[model samples]
Every structure is written in structure tokens, then in C-alpha cells.
Target: MTIKSFSFSQLADMRIEGVGIHASYSIDIVIKDENSSSGKNVYISATGKSNAARAAGTGSLLFWCKVRDLLSNKIYSLERKKGEGFAVGFDDFVIGSIMFHIPYNSSSAPKIELEAGYLYDAGYAGTVIPFPRSLKRVIALTQFNRR
Candidate 1:
């Protein structure tokens, strides 16, 4: 079994007035492989604080995660099981995480690209802000198998 982890810290503040969201966030991603037939699992965790007051029932603050298989150019998005996202208000904070599995054959290793960020929606429209350049990464799974 092998595991790879990456961390990201935001350098600047991000805000979307449409939903009245202002925050600074950090994210951690972990990829784990058990060398089994099932494949690999990817986990994403987001932690942040909201510094401003949210619009009165006008919108919501949400987190998003996406993974891409560089070899096949296929993108897989996180599936939210429970509520949409964190329930944050003025001077509030949130810590949320999601996980998904990717299936692949053992004969070959694929390079994976990951992207994560915040999404603000005002019922009518929405805005998406990527975490940061450092948060977006391309990882080669083969490296983990090296002895």
C-alpha cells in the first residue's frame, strides 16, 4: 500500500458578494492505494473561515473537488452525499471533507490532475474560485511504486 499527500494554503482572501462570502481557506488531499483490485481512493479536506455576513437566504457557500486522469482525459467530480456544503454565517468557520474512488488496471499507472475550490451560489447564479495555483497539481502514481 502507498499513500501520497499534498497541502495548500491560500495567500489572499477570496470573496463572492453574490452570496456574501469572504474567506481564507486551506485544503489537504490524500491519495491511497492498497494494491488491490478495487483501485485507489482520493480524499479531499477543506478548512476555512467566513469573515463576512452571508446574504439573507440568498445563496450558499460550497466546496468542490475534481480529479482528472491525464492519460484518458477523463474528469471525475466529488459526489456530495449529505447537504450541499457548510452552513456558515457571519464570523463562522467550516471544515469539510469528501472522498471518492478511482478504478484502474494494475498493468499501468496514470498521471492524475486534481483541482479544488470554493463555490458561491445565489440561487440565480454562482461563482467558482479555485483554491490557488499551488492547490492544482499533477501527480504520477508510478512514483509511489518505486523502491
Candidate 2:
């Protein structure tokens, strides 16, 4: 089986009471078994940086997936909590990884897609001072262009 990989990066900036905050992050995805020709599978991974010390809190990471049910026209999802398979030390920059599984039945599987979201300094109180900062969330998808 051949492995394919992709990467993404995102940025979020918000202002509350004139306080500016920013966050930025990036992630990588690796497909360990793309040659199955049976179906499609996906994996999610990421890394981030914050201006505040210990901002990420043990470098926590969360992974989520959205799946659609063809028969019912409904969507389903799977998620993983922080500290599942990655680590975030005391450093200002933290890296993490999460894996997702999709089964392609060779005749009934659709392409796999992944999305990611992140919050920076969630618990910080908004003040009148402008902080000129940004927050970022990175998303990566594998098998995105494969049929």
C-alpha cells in the first residue's frame, strides 16, 4: 500500500472590548494504506503556537470527523479527545496527531474529507486593552483528489 499526505494551516483573530487576539496553527495528514483500492481512509494531525506561556495546556488536541448517511440524508461524526496519541509539553509550540478510519467497499464508498477547528486563550477575560493577536487551526486531508 502506498501512503499519501497533505497539510493545512488556519488563522483566527477576534476583538472583544477592543482587545485584539490572534492564533495560528498547522497540521499534517498521512494515509498509510492508500493502495487498497477497496475504499477511502483519512487521518488528521496538527501543530500550533501561542504567545502566552502554557497557553495550550499540556498541548491538548482534539479530532473530529463528519460522515454522511446516504439513505437518510443525515450526517454523523467521530471525535477524539486531547492526549489520546500525541503530546504538548511546556513549550510555546505544541504538536499533536489524530487518526481517522474510513472503509471503502470498492463500490459504495465516497471520498473522505476532514475539517479542523481550534480556540486560543478561551478562558482569558476580555479587557479594554487591544491585544493584537491571532488564533489558528490547521486541517489536513488525505485522498482528497483521489477517485
Candidate 3:
């Protein structure tokens, strides 16, 4: 798959304090293998960090993801904390370790544009450190007969 990512603003590795909004980006995924089948596993991932741990009552890294399949004309979207839940300490964060399954009836390599955004939680005004991160992979996966 060919992936092209476009960011409105390059997330600089700068310390962010209080309520802040990071950049937004769009990822374009192209399927090169014509044999790739529906229900194929497409991995979409985002990662970043914070300057300090967010308080229990507050959120640090908030992320939003929207995916659109041009071939099937279907759209999937979700939003959640980057750490997947209330987190304190441990600068690392992920979108809950999830994989996006290609929708059915997707014979042609569906053109997908994933839009993502990052925001710092209010109230607690946590500090965060932005990082450049976007992972997308397309692979034809089939059930194993031996299994």
C-alpha cells in the first residue's frame, strides 16, 4: 500500500502547557496488490508523549481519527485518549492498540483518507510534548488452514 500523509502543522517537539491544540493531518492509503481481499487487516496507529503526567482528573493527549473508504463509500471514525484511558506518569501513549479491518465489498484498493487531530485536555491543563507519528499498513491476511 502507498501511504501519503499531509499535516496542517508539523507537530514540533515543544513543551505544551495548559489547554492546547496540536496539528491535524490526513493519511492517504493506496492498495497496490489487486489480489488483496475484503476484511483485510489495515493497521492505523498514532503515538505521542507528554511533558509530565496528567493528573487523575485531567486528560493529557486526546486524539481523533476518521477513516473513509472511497471504494465502498463507507466511513469509520473514533476518538479517545491517546493513552487509551486516564493516565498518570509513563510518557508513552497509544490509541488502545487497535487494527482497522477493511470493509467488505472492497475489491478495488479503496482510497482511504484518515483525518486525525490532537488536543490537550482542559481543566487540569496538563503538559504535553508532541511527536511526529503516523503508522498505516495494508496487508492481505487469510485464515490459515493449519490453524
> What residue runs in model 3 are displaced by over 4 Å at the alpha carbon?
1-9, 12-43, 50-59, 81-90, 97-108, 124-147
lDDT value, candidate 1, whole model: 0.52
- Off by more than 4 A, model 2: 16-21, 37-110, 121-147
Q: Could you arrange the candidates by TM-score from highest to lowest?
A: 1, 2, 3
Pick the winner on lDDT between candidates 2 and 3. Answer: 3
Worst-scoring 10-residue span by lDDT in model 2: 126-135
* Ranking 1 against 3 by lDDT, winner: 1
Measured against the true structure, the TM-scores of the candidates, in listed sequence, are: 0.54, 0.44, 0.43
Ranking by lDDT: 1, 3, 2
* Candidate 2 whole-model C-alpha lDDT, 0 to 1: 0.38
Q: Write the per-residue lDDT of candidate 1 for residues 34-141, one digit (tens) a residue.
A: 533556665544443333225334445455567787756777775342244454554333445555555665456757787665554445564445334224767776
Most lDDT-accurate candidate? 1
Candidate 3 residues 87-117, lDDT tens each?
3336544433234555555335445655554
Report the lDDT tens digits of candidate 2 across residue range 45-145.
44443332233232232433343333223344444444343445432233444444455433443344444443333333422211223222332223423
